[model samples]
Target: MKALLSLALLLTWLGRCTGAAQVFMEPQLRARAGDSVLLQCLFLDPDSKGWTLHKVDWLHRAGAGTQEEMVFFYYSNHGVPAGRFKHRVQWRGNISRWDGSILLQDLRLNDSGTYECELRLLETSSVFMRCEGSAAQVWGASLLLPSSVTACVPSAPKPPGLCQQRGQPGPGAC
Candidate 1:
């Protein structure tokens, strides 16, 4: 009987740990060249400890391989843009509530493709301490092609914005 009761408690604990605390992106958004977009993120946690958002970014898969590059960084209070991504992206969410939504203005042909909105959170405790969650991954932030762009048309050369050397965080890497 004791063993069965213990198993029940363990299952309950596991359920909470893997519960809805996960972060997710709304959907793949598309914008015309020189247009703007609103990146949305939802934090599905019910606990009142609140959330502290950190290290929000937008990544684009460069070339024909699987790896991607970081075009924007949203930490340290400044949305530092890579030399190329400058004047192209901005954060649209409220900094205080962990709304990590971002805004990207002026979509270029080089911007057409799959883009992902990456984000992190710091959950506070009753002891006045904080705990950070793993980086969440969402797929399919596709750039919609304007009627002007042909299927055979290759986008312009992307400004070199790689994430590898930038000390950027990865999904579950934090």
Candidate 2:
């Protein structure tokens, strides 16, 4: 009986450690030239204890044939913006809250494309944990600037009732 009890406890612990989290962002975003846009990357961690954030990287791709450019990098409480993104990218995220969002100011026509956010999490012991989540993308524009634009739509189909469970009305419900 003691052995069975021990096995049960071990299973419970494993379940807690393996709980999955969802990392998402505004699947699509639109901003005009010279405007500013916020690319929100949020992680809904299933573990109540929360995980330690190790780093976050943001990349951008201009078009189909273009290579992805490293736009931003954050680690050890420091942020670095690369290339043309220097001085234009702002770290608006908080590690404590699992928010890896960012703000891109002074948008240019060449910035019209897709942006991706990559995140890494670590265990309390500072050991690398398995990365298990999806990324979000943002689409930029240079024409027909809207005075005030704030919208988010999932880029792909999510599990039914997941958004509702989060008190969100799901895509197109906005």
Candidate 3:
């Protein structure tokens, strides 16, 4: 009986050391340009048996057939978004709560792409278990006008040399 008890105890301990947490995220989202999108990412800790949050990486892939870019990261501290996401992405979830969600603000048409939330957990055996989930975003018909663009609203008067005739070769049609 003592041998059987020891075997059972060993099995339980081994299971705890090899367990990995699972990540969850929305599958798809449809939004309009110039809007904010909250990419929800939550994880399961399984009663905190032996897993601890190590790192969280937020990745984005522009359109299709493109490489994913790590837009943000959290390592029990904070992450500063860089490059095109410098002033756009915001990490709104807490690692302690097993939430890795991020809020994508001031979204433009170019922001329509696939986003991934990756989580790394340290197991009881000092090994790392990686979990990742992704979601695809579709943006509505719209444009992000830059400072150099003189595009006018339908109600506004067309600017000089800005609006060209439909058949003429110039900028955009009024």
Clashes of each: 2, 0, 0
lDDT of 3 by residue, 43-140 (tens): 54444455577677777666457787767777758766756887898878777876777777776656544455556665423323233323332323
TM-score of each: 0.50, 0.59, 0.57
Runs of candidate 3 exceeding 4 Å displacement:
1-21, 123-174
TM-score of 1: 0.50
User: lDDT of each structure?
Assistant: 0.40, 0.53, 0.48
**Once superposed on the true structure, which residue ranges of model 2 sit more than 4 Å away at CA?**
1-20, 123-160, 163-174
**Distance (Å) between predicted and true CA of 154, model 3?**
41
Give the best candidate by lDDT: 2
Best by TM-score: 2
Please provide, for model 2 over 43-128, each residue's C-alpha lDDT reduced to its tens digit, 9 standing for 90 to 100.
Answer: 56434445666787777766556787888878889888898899899988886776677788886656654565666666533322
Q: Name the 10 consecutive residues with the lowest summed lDDT in model 3.
A: 2-11
* Model 1 C-alpha lDDT per residue in residues 10-117, reported as the tens digit of each score: 000112234334443321223444566554543334244344555556565533455666666677677766646677767666556555555666655555434445
Stretches of model 1 off by over 4 angstroms after superposition: 1-17, 22-30, 46-51, 63-67, 122-174
- Residue 37 lDDT, candidate 2, scale 0-100: 69
